[model samples]
Target: MTTCRLCGSSNLASVVDLGATPPCERFLTSEQLDEEEPSFPLHLRVCTSCWLAQIPPLITPEETFTEYAYFSSYSRSWVDHAKSFVDAAVDRLALGRDSFVVEVASNDGYLLKHVVQQGIRCLGIEPSRNVGEAARAEGVPTSTTFLSESSGSEVRDGHGPADLVVANNVYAHIPDIVGFTKGLRALVADDGWVSIEVQHLLTLINNVQYDTIYHEHFQYYTVESARNALDSGGLSLVDVELLDTHGGSIRLWARPREVTGEQSARMVDVLEKEKAAGLHELSGYADFSANVTRVRLDLLRFLVAMEEAGKSVVGYGAPGKGNTLLNHCGIRTDLLPYTVDRNPYKHGRFTPGTRIPVLPPERIAADRPDYVLVLPWNLKAEIMTQLSYVAEWGGKLVFPIPRLEIVEVNS
Candidate 1:
């Protein structure tokens, strides 16, 4: 039985099934890929008890990100986001020179560079060796190992309890969600805080973002479900914020159970909303499969029409969601000429299953395709702004999910 990762409920309903897919980061060389790359089941199910959306068991952190291909320094907007986050956190927590901040899955020290610039002592725990090296290059101290109970113990011995621990878009990535949170308990100092930003389940359902379903993201979180997980790990949520980043996300602030303060009204507000929306009810997941079916049809129809029109469609950002959407919709090189990524690690490789070639963003500009499909719909605004020059040649940008629409940008 595929039990709920959070509540251990055995009742799980299969929602969206994206059949065997390669890990999103495993972009393969043309020669190696032609020899037949492996793919795994990409099925997602919502636990009836906790409403935690997750994929069927497959892959591990070591399998997904250890020799990771992604580097945060590639994205200009992301670097800005990281810098702003450091500023916001330092002020919000009244952190000073004496304070120490630790970031889990702190890819390439994107955020901590700014923390260090502010003269705040910071440490990054990154599992991916390549990205960890990049963080080290940026002068941000990093530990290149998975953050778990054992790793947390080692971290505590060296850095003591951390004043602030930041986990951005990482809560959903681990298979052992409980053990991961328990590690937080062992590492955080008294009066310390943990802030985790996860793609919201509410947004997933409403937007029909079934493409976000993949093995790397082992669990989808709702405010209520996350609170339950934290409670089990001996922590309390002191605040919660709705962030516009990552399509839609919830930033949760937590501290140890014994620590008490007036809980942020935002936290109570989100909890009440989740309850009212039936996130805590068993029946909430029943209709999600139907919604996913509709999304698949809508996307396939759009792609077929674009192909028939002889319009060259290219994809932007080789994100996990793009992989699911492409594999689920049966899109191949016939429909997509190639996809571009800003990350050099993804260059010179083909996307798994579909075998669409991954190229640098300049390829899109140089080719001047009629339509550039925005794959990472969450960052459509950021991408559109970056590629605004596409409009100079009268090219239009298209978004496939949640209905297809074309918007023009002034160069």
Candidate 2:
């Protein structure tokens, strides 16, 4: 029986059963590709008690993250997004050399590096040893340890309380949700603020973004559930902004519940929208499974048609979401010859379950595929621009999620 992680309630409503899927980032070597791969049920559950939507962390964090495959700095668009966030955050907070910034799960210091460039004091708490070490080498003060109430207090004792804490796309991956968020509470100063960005659950359902559901992600949060999770850690919402990244995301600004602050209009506005969409009830999940099934069938038809048309198809990025899509749709190198990625770590490896060979981005031109299926559709604009030369040979770009469609862009 599945139970809600936060409230300890047994009333879990099944949202979508995604069969069994391997952990998304487990890119294999050629030799290991022949080895048997283990997979777990990709079932998602929503708590009728607290209305928190989550999937169990079927694999251990040590198994999933120690020597990680994903490095955040590889995506130029994502890096620029981080830099822009830094500029706005520094100015909005009136931060300077006097303020301290702590970023949890600061992958390769992608965001904190910008914080350091501005001469602000910054610390990165990264669990992935390789990624954390890389962050330190890049001159972002990084600690290679998981954040918890005890460890967070130790960090505060050594470096003093943080003035601003940033956590983007990290909370969902956590298994011990309450403990970790409580740690975030302990890490910040009384007057300090915490900013968290997570993909909105409402958007996931509407867009049929089941591909975003993988073993690494333990929970898919809505505004209501997110607020409750933060409140459990003694935090209260101060502001929120809806972002278009990762399909769709919500940026929440929170402060300690003890520190009085008025809720921003945007935060309240989003909360109402979430409520109107029935996010607080189990009915919000009714159509989710049906939508996901329709998407799977639609994607298969598109790929099959393109192959029969004598067109060569290759994938653009080997993101975790890409693995989910490929594995669920059961596409292999037969349907898609190969895929390319900018990160050198993934260059010689094969994607997890599908075992598609991954190559360097430069290989695309030589292979000269007719249709470049962008696996990481969230960053399609940046990728399409970088590979605009594909249009020179009459190649087209295709997006696999939201719908299977060919997107027209500048060559």
RMSD of each: 1.5, 1.1
Query: How high is each candidate's TM-score?
Result: 0.96, 0.98
How many backbone clashes are present in model 1?
0
Steric collisions counted per model: 0, 0
User: What do the candidate models score in CA lDDT, each in turn?
Assistant: 0.84, 0.89
Candidate 2 Cα errors over 4 Å, as ranges: none
Error of 1 at 84 (Å): 1.9
Least lDDT summed over 10 consecutive residues: which range in candidate 1? 277-286
Residue pair clashes in candidate 2: none
Model 2, position 299, has a per-residue lDDT of 77
Candidate 1 deviant stretches above 4 angstroms: none
Candidate 1 differs from the real structure by a C-alpha RMSD in angstroms, to one decimal, of 1.5
